[model samples]
Target: MGQNLANHLVPSQDYDLICENLAQTKEGADILRLKGGIPLANLETVTPQLKRLKIGAVLNGKELAAIGKILRSTSEIRRFFKEITTPEVPLPTLNQLLIRLESLPELTKVLNLSLEDDGYVRDEASPLLRSLRRQISGTEDEIRQRLVSFTKGSQAKYLTNAVVTMRDDRYVIPVKTEYKKHFGGMVHDQSASGATVFVEPKAIVELNNRLRQQQAKEHEEILRVLRELSQEVAPYTEEIDQNMRILGQLDFVNAKARYAADLKATQPELSAENDIYLRQVWHPLLDAKKAVKNDLAIGKDYKAIVITGPNTGGKTITLKTLGLIQLMGQSGLFIPAGEHSRIGVFTEIFADIGDEQSIEQSLSTFSSHMVNIVEILKHVDDKSLVLFDELGAGTDPQEGAALAISILDAVGAKGSYVVATTHYPELKAYGFERPETINASMEFDVETLQPTYRLLLGIPGRSNALEISLRLGLDTMVVEAARQLTSQSSQDLNEMIADLVEKRHTAEEEAISLNKYLTEAEKLHNDLRKAYNNFVSQRDSLLNQAKAKANEIVENTRKQTADVISDLHKMQQSAGNGVKENELIDAKTRLNKLEQPIHLQKNKVLQRAKAKKIFKEGDEVLVKSYGQRGTLMKKAGNHVWEVQIGILKMKLDEADLEKIAEEKPQKTVNRASVKRSRSVRTSASLDLRGKRYEEAMNEVDRYIDEAIMAGFPSVTIIHGKGTGALRKGITEYLQSNRVVKHFEYAPPNAGGNGATIVSFK
Candidate 1:
């Protein structure tokens, strides 16, 4: 699908990789092996064809290869297929392959190829064919049995081996060179050493005649059968060829889809109304585990982005990713990016991206770049994507910056999406001046003095030439002298840009820190909520249990009271109102004692647990059961105090807080240090075996989240060997996950390779 601009948009190396991933069958491979892009319309039929192929099981490689050969013209297949013999692909294979072709169903159904000998026309192809084969079988058997008897009787000693062997398709026996005249009817062949002769016995000569006659008749019958089958097939050869062509196209499409799957690539959102917005986009040509992700936006805000950074900070590579991803997307190939990445279909993509200064072309670097740019301008339109690397580089700085800005303006006037990279400070300043253009920078770590490879949008980059020179053993006097030579405005601008870069870095670091803490706080909050609910539930359950037991005791006490009262009443009745007052007093006392213990137990169980200790602002307090420390901001009405820890704030119950001695207070967790600590104890992989699908994925999600937050470049997942359901589920999850860049099966010796190694962005 991407044959036209491929040469310009992708390097030769990357083009080869894309083609390699797009080929399956030899025909498909041959088609992909071509250097140029095919028209997009040519790929339209591929979808339905692919859906058809996808419904069937994977075809055998040999069978697929053979079938692919049928679509090749005789001239194209000449090197591999000689004119002397035609490949007699069995009818069954052809029929099996063409099972879905409506026109050839009848021919395919009646074609019996089960008894075909190695794809050759079968002896049971027809009744006449079967009769001819029967005669041959009978005659051959008679010859073999007679020969076996002869060898066993006396000729066994003369033969090299006792079994009958075929020479020139005729049964023969190996006899000693000296004894050849005695045993042979006709010497069919001789050994290279002249030590043995393969001969037909005189006794079996007549039998050989009969077998040869039958074989001749069988050959004729086979030809007749073949002719009959060929006649039936000839009428539908066009349809058969068409089906093969469709199959090959499907194979190519499937190969691309499979490759995308392997690379964890996604079909980016296609937006015709907007310019490109690539989120966490990575170059498919680079190693997924190592490639840094970048967020890029062109249009909807600015039509062009001028990226600047140190050499090899991916300034050039960024240009290439944008160009290649556009080409890939328009070509119906998935891009290596996160979901929600939007790419507009470019009518044309023109790239002057690499150092095309050709000595052989007798052109200087600037001339070559200008030459390509001139050509690019001629064809660029509103629907085009233009990529330029170090625009106007091989020239004077003043002229180059002016030229670059002008080129961007010209391309922008065409309404084309434009991206260019340059180190010129003047160009960086121009980015601020232009209303339709913005500046982006590749981040560099000041502490490690290395490239972080993170692309920061909306900030210009400063050339760290002075700082780098000073750090790399340059004399302070020389650096100061160089600084003095530069204008005050230039120096001031450089300082401002450097400060901005540093501040941006700090801001990003703070964000990551905030994220980590928020996650921890959330987890802690959930745990606390769970524990509190459990405590309340258990308390209520215990209270219910206690009240139930008390009720039962009260019921027994009431029964006793009733019995006492009844006895009193009986006494009154029996004694005519002369009941015993002592018995009634004793019964009431027993009832009072039973009710007293219940009141005391109820008072103990139902007591309110409010804080007695006073806590105020600036106090270091521990959130009980949370194992976290926070500073009290203020008391919020009745016993609820607001606590602050870093960016986290919450109102906690008085009982949930315990004032802690400021000495040896709960230390704040350092996110960077937490990330670095993975070097100490974290294993590179997480194993999820024998867990249910939901349970396994839940654990996998947490494991991956922790790994990402820990700043792991990559990690492994061991889901054990099974029916591949677990691996598939995990893979799908990874594909949709924001943290995962890409994933692959682990190498051997790391549990089953069904266990995948995941990379994080």
Candidate 2:
């Protein structure tokens, strides 16, 4: 179970990363060491194949000694010599290859080659190689001949019908004998009063000695090569190991991400805000194959949710889904959610789910639950997400409901978010009375007498057990008699139960219809938003083009006018000094004509006022240097006015303001206008909103400029305190700003510090 669970938790590809992170954690470190894969890169190369071999074989003394010798000799002899002789440092290409041979594919191939190939070539040049090869071959041939000769001699005798010799110990053979004389040539150990005899033949004994000598020599050679190779490759060993480790980590991370995505049933879009937001979320483990998807909304509005439903519903699954998703998210995996889903960082996640009762400890279900709850209560604060499956369910319903409500109230008061599942009716009623609590239920189909597995919000379910039993063919007379024996209040409760069932069913149908509508509406909304954005972008582009065209026309007109003036001045100079009075008048006339247009142009400039007092209270104005606009709320001075925009309040001079309208009465500040103005101002100071790449950069630039100009020691710009756009925008901007001394999110005390505080140089 552990291995299988590990397989799901850490993918083979991501094993390295999991191992590295595991190495960092106390538990992971222990597992990694126990697995004997340290510096996980090197360990990983061996683990896959190592898993296949017997543990005893891999860890045996002979094998270890052999491996050690190979590594030492290869680096010291082969690699060192190559490196010193080469122009550049020689890399152990072959050595690296050998190290990688520990992988399954390579090891399998090596074993196959060793077994299939005789590889008995005698080296003619080197006497040692030749002698070793000859000795090995000769011993093998002599052993074969002697075994055949012994068997033939034994068959001729009457002691046995046939004889066979088999290798047992290193130099010993078991010989089944038909003749007694052949056994005299070899030392024999009788088995069970000489029914079978073990023989130590001279040829076999000499073969063992030769084999040992050859093995030792081969071992020495391999060790020499391995040592040299290790040295040559030593530089890149760390890097390779690191890469392998990273690869392992990535594999596990990717798997976790994929699982989260699958569990979420949708892809979560990457964002900079760390706040988690989900709309209509369903529990992934709630028999999703058969269960109806529940719509759960969380994050922005209700940070904590209390779910109430009848017994045998899917409350536990809901808790598990939430807990699992959070775990997946923190491990740096993608979550399963809509593109708009935003998940935040949590310090810890505690769950009190499943039947935790322990008979050995003399604890009842309630006591067990209480113990777990107490542990959770002690550790949880804001920034932690708590899940309780069937909180306070095993004790008396009245007291249990009270305990549950109190626990929820306490957690909520601490500002920590929680989600708990319960079946207590009073607890469900409590949801209505409490402002922070919301009611939800797992639906049951009355007609079919089965759980629909659909979750409905804003409503609670009553146990439909009696109704279901009746529907399932229980005797009507028995049911009627039982109903008669019940109290009037109980009958009335049953009637109410019937009504709620009808309402719940209706709600379930309506919810399905609504979800279909919502899906369609969401798609349409997305399309419309895209089109609107495209139109705005195109309009901006066209506007820029028009401005460029207008500038070109104005420049052309100015150049033409200058040329005409120059020509007129030249003509006036060329006129002779002794000309007739009429000619002199004509020359003066031409001069006057040329100068007239110049005077007209100068008058046009003078027609406009040098300064216009267009500023008014409640008027929206654009600051020239600043990219944002604000509304004028009060007059501060002859040239200074106070503006209230979005979350920003500032004072600006009239010279820096331009009225949005040329000729209009001051309009009342509508909510939308105020919102737009606020959005504009917020945009200027690193809008930590849902901004992306280039858009964020622009905001950062504006923020730095504003911070520097305002001479603020430190000023905070609100970014919604999410994990997405705002935070990313601020960090990226801070990276390059020359004037920024430092910037970070404000401390928790100041509005929970969802804003970024920047100090300028």
Candidate 3:
């Protein structure tokens, strides 16, 4: 979009809504100006630093937000402090400056006392400022004590109420109307009913006088403090101003993000290819819930599309959606479209949309449109997006259609993308006559007599005048007569359009029915597949249960046979000559037969174990408990192995030895790729030579994780001990990492306090 396009879009429906939203996020006028300012001349060459400020607050013994607001305002600061007395340096306008400095940091090196998130300078800028505040607090306490004593004394009788209230910054008591003369002090104010008077008693007059004196001193001291703060700020006025500008830019950017979120917008791919392919794009100006999303393509084969439709059928809105979204993209705002949408960088965008005629300039609608089109044609190029509405509709139909065609040809010759809306029948044929243009229309329901607002491409629209007239109760004879009066060719074209719309509508219904059936079939297929899987799982579970029971029975039978054989042997030994050798042999044979099944089961279990066993005599494995890698020397026993780790052979459980995949030869990496990877790597060491405190702290987190993953025994972080902030932050982070066994400052021979060495567990 061109620089001039914003003005055209600002007047379009809801386009300015975006600008208003951007204005709301800004905190101050300085930022608003920066957001509204003209584009930079050359962004590539601009390296100006953004202005920034650190602030602290002065608590006046309250947590009231209103008081905080007053304290933060530039106008309030100026009113309270009055003017600086010293003539050494001139201060900037106080009403625009947020703070006034009285003493330099040399008197008190303090800054960054946050009062609020929007950011305001705290009153405690220096040590002198803090000291003066303390004195004020003490004086206020004394005054409160004096007022309490007086209210409890003889004056308690005259006092309408014992409560003390302040009037014009002076501690006052409410006295009864009849006893006003008894109080030998000035009356400040009276109640609305005049039933009582607020007075400062003469008895505490001396205390009040002392309090006043202290306040005067406080005021003077505050002015001095503000002047000192102002002096510090004066040196960096440029930086402060720039900070405001950058903050405002960010505020606007954030607003756009919020607006895009509301619209469910996606970021569009940008290109200089001079093509636009939009999908599921809804007009931001229209109600998104009801809006019919449409697809539009331009600068691909065709340079222009002539859209025609009945009145109020959304041709104009489609044009506006195209124009507005393009402007939004060029201005760095997200477009409300699908991820497939792409936008080309156009140097200029021209629009003759709506009725932009100027009566004050004595330009009729046609003349006004022509004047805009002439300017557009003179400057439009292959990189421009030009739009027109109701093109050539305010003049004679024949001449207007001719002129519209001529203009489309001109734009096409220049290779610029153009979209125009028209109601002229002759103009509808222009799209067919020109190879670089196509026709589109908004769909309308013939039966409901309502516009669908659905843009249908590759289709020309009909006027539908006769049908509307007939529906409005016009004489059927007159409507029929009007249709017959039109040329045969025109009548034939209208008949063809009617037939085409009917066929498309029927096809759409059939397609919808077919889709519904397909969806149902797919659901049924998924359900059957899920049922089959469940059946297979149940069958496997039952089979495993049966196999377990059979094994249990075989073990029990073998145990019984062994016990019986043992008893028989005992009996035979005791009864010396009673049993024959054959009978004893038969008993042993029976025992062997019972034990065969147990032996076969045992052999099957051994075979399965042998199938899964990973370690061999020569295979290398890692001993996790000892954190060492070694080869398996031999198999010691069931579920255990003898492994040699670092020349020491020990019997270990198989679970203790983890199988390590043999390392493959490292793939050769190009020298350039190695350098690139290193530049982006956070390895066993991190060097924060010149980074800020925040950046250095963040980098430390990534550095530690990389070192642990790389299996480094120890890692070093170099954060030069400048003011010790960076070093302190890095050390604190290192302490939080669970992987670190210990960390300490490097020795003097190394980087000393400038670097920390950490050992990982």
Candidate 4:
């Protein structure tokens, strides 16, 4: 079933996320890990070519191992060449001398001696030296050419043997031995093996020998560097492994998301929530360009919505939309809907949207649907979403309606949500009678004699077939005759249906008008609130200024009165010869004049009271630290109020709380903030050792943001020594950050070049 779905389905964003998440699990890790494998360090060298091939999946661990082994061998050859080179000779200079020797007309002349007279015999000398001397003399050129061809051919064969591409789950790599022309390569021990090919010509063997000697010397230096690098990286090997695993998982997830999108034939909004909801959703398979948008709300109201409409309406399309969206949602992809739409989690989405007739089972269309329903019944639960399109259409009206009702009842009993489209009038009436059932219909235009494709809730449509047929050129007389032969009750029913249609239209228009009025009212309310807040703020500021001025005047008066009293006491003391009562009285009057009474007017007190009236208890409010939603429990003694919020109790003043309506929910904390908190608590930030220069730089940017938000004054980013790519990336991110104060590579005891210590401003 999985394979079948994969084949038929198109990739979607949700699928990609699923695949990636799945790849992160134990199973995915197992797929990438192999025994007796070449180290991943070697594999890094071949990643560029692998990326060029666009190969994303771990086809087999062995294949990756093989590639790693080849790279390791190449590394060894490079080391060997470096080791043989002379220490005194500069690599470039030595390479230049070798090139000149090869360009000479004769090696014997270039060497300033004949090979025959030299202590070295042709065969006794190094094969590389013999080839180089012969080639320099322009002798044995043909032999050198043949050797080059052989080496090139062998190398090509070896690579071909190592790599294979799969098509339709079968490996395709054409391999052959020199003896077999048609049989491809003879499989030995179930694995293809081939000889190593050296493309360099044998006539240039002498040049190769000299080069090898120079390389040997260089190899020792390279080995030393490698040893140091390995030690630097050893501490971070685990971290690098983790990153590779994560990248692999992401690759898988991306692929799945793409596939799901294609299968649903729609783009779904991506979210990381547990529920799915969509409003005004359309069927992807339907010609949305021509199809109407139908508003469907699932997950909260009636589990089973029975849609009843006239023939050729949009009942089936609605069913398909519901099913497709569920499939897309479960796959972790987004669906097309209004921004406010949400989806709920469902374990399974069982759909019977189209005919499932099977001749082999001797089942008619009705029987086929029944069979499918039976299958659904066995597995149906609260976590399952079921959709039945045109249920009971192929069977007798009375029996089918009864059957459909029973099926819906059973499904509801199982606690599963079901949406079934039907044409049975009995079923429609049943929907009206049931509390959990809702009746919906597609609107048809009587004047135009066409389906409007608009779905109406709480209504059932009448079959306007005969009337439409007549309008479409059928004889009016025939339609009239047919109507006459119908029972009186039936005729009354048709008239009642017409009356209901008119009322529905009127109701719809009134609903639209009401919405418009509500919108305008809301806008007015907001404007008034803003104006009131501004008025209150200005009033408070003005009152504060007035109070300050009053205090200043009072202080000045007190100072003047104190100075006058001191002068009065001095005068009394000086007039000790004969101090009259009238003179003392005059001194007191002067003091009284200096100290004028300070009293606030009644209007000032009223203004203060008015300013204090803006805040009240029991109001839903927003606090800075609590984000956008907190409840004001009660006002404390003076201005403080105690509030309860999400396991936190805070005592805040009126100035700290901003009133917010209860209707709107608060925005969630940012994901980066959450990750930062976790990192701080766990002390596990990203380790960029062994990563590419670009990757390390990206990690550095992410880490800095996280560290700052986590309240870390400083952090250590480990960037192991390997060409300094990781170090460079860390330094670059640090330099660009406004928050970063400075950074430096750690000292040897701390981590050396293998880590960087970043200080945050």
Tell me the number of clashing residue pairs for each predicted model. Answer: 3, 42, 19, 59
List the candidate numbers ranked by TM-score, top first: 1, 3, 2, 4
Q: Put down candidate 3 lDDT per residue, 490-594, tens digits, no spaces.
A: 667656765764575456456546877999999999999999999999989988997898899788877878786787878667665554332443455455445
What are the models' TM-scores?
A: 0.52, 0.44, 0.51, 0.40
Off by over 4 Å in 3: 1-109, 114-138, 176-198, 356-363, 464-761
For candidate 2, write residues 514-564 as lDDT tens digits: 877999999999999999999999999999998997788677766766765
lDDT of 2: 0.55
Q: Which candidate achieves the best TM-score against the true structure?
A: 1
Q: Residues 1-761, candidate 4, lDDT per residue (tens digit)?
A: 12333455443335444433332221222222321111123223233324423432321223333332333333433343355445542334223222321111222131122113221223222345444444444533443443334335444453334433322222233233342332232232222354322122333445445544544544444334333323433333333333333333233433444443343333333334323445567766655466577666555446667888877787877777777776655454445554444455566778887787888989899988888888999999887788888887698888888988888899989988888888888887777677667777888897797788887765666687777888888889999888888668755654665577457546645764687799999999999999999999999999999899789978887888788678777766766444333334345545545443434355787668555546667676765432435667787868788875533345777655667644545576321112123221225345876667776676676556445545577888887887875666667767866667888888899888788888877
Q: What is the lDDT ranking, best to worst?
A: 1, 3, 4, 2
The deviation in Å at residue 471 for candidate 2 is: 7.1
Residue 185 miss distance in model 1 (angstroms)? 1.6
Candidate 1: residue pairs that collide: 3-36, 3-37, 4-37
Candidate 4 TM-score, true structure as reference: 0.40
In angstroms, how far off is 508's CA in candidate 1?
A: 17
Query: Which wins on TM-score, candidate 2 or candidate 4?
Result: 2
RMSD of 1: 28.1
Native-to-model Cα distance after best TM-score fit, residue 235 in candidate 4, in Å: 3.4
Consecutive 10-residue window with the lowest summed lDDT within model 3: 670-679
> Model 1: per-residue lDDT, tens digit, 1-761?
22322323332223334333322222222323341211112221222323334454332223222332333222222222232223442223222333444334455443534122134555456888778877887888889898897678677888776778878778888888888888759999999999988998898888888888888887777656654554454445456556545444444454655557667777666676556778778988888888898877787777888988888788888888888887777665778987657777666778887777778989998999999999999999887778888998999998999899898899988888888899887878778888888788888875567988888776778676778888888999999998888779866765676677567546655654687799999999999999999999999999999899888987887787787678667766665435333333334445444443212334543443223346779888775533456789988879788877433456778766778755653567331111122433346788788888889988987676456534578988889888888889998988987656788887887665668988876
* Regions more than 4 Å wrong, model 2: 1-131, 146-179, 182-184, 191-193, 196-247, 250-288, 332-342, 354-367, 392-402, 424-436, 462-761
lDDT of 4 at 110: 18
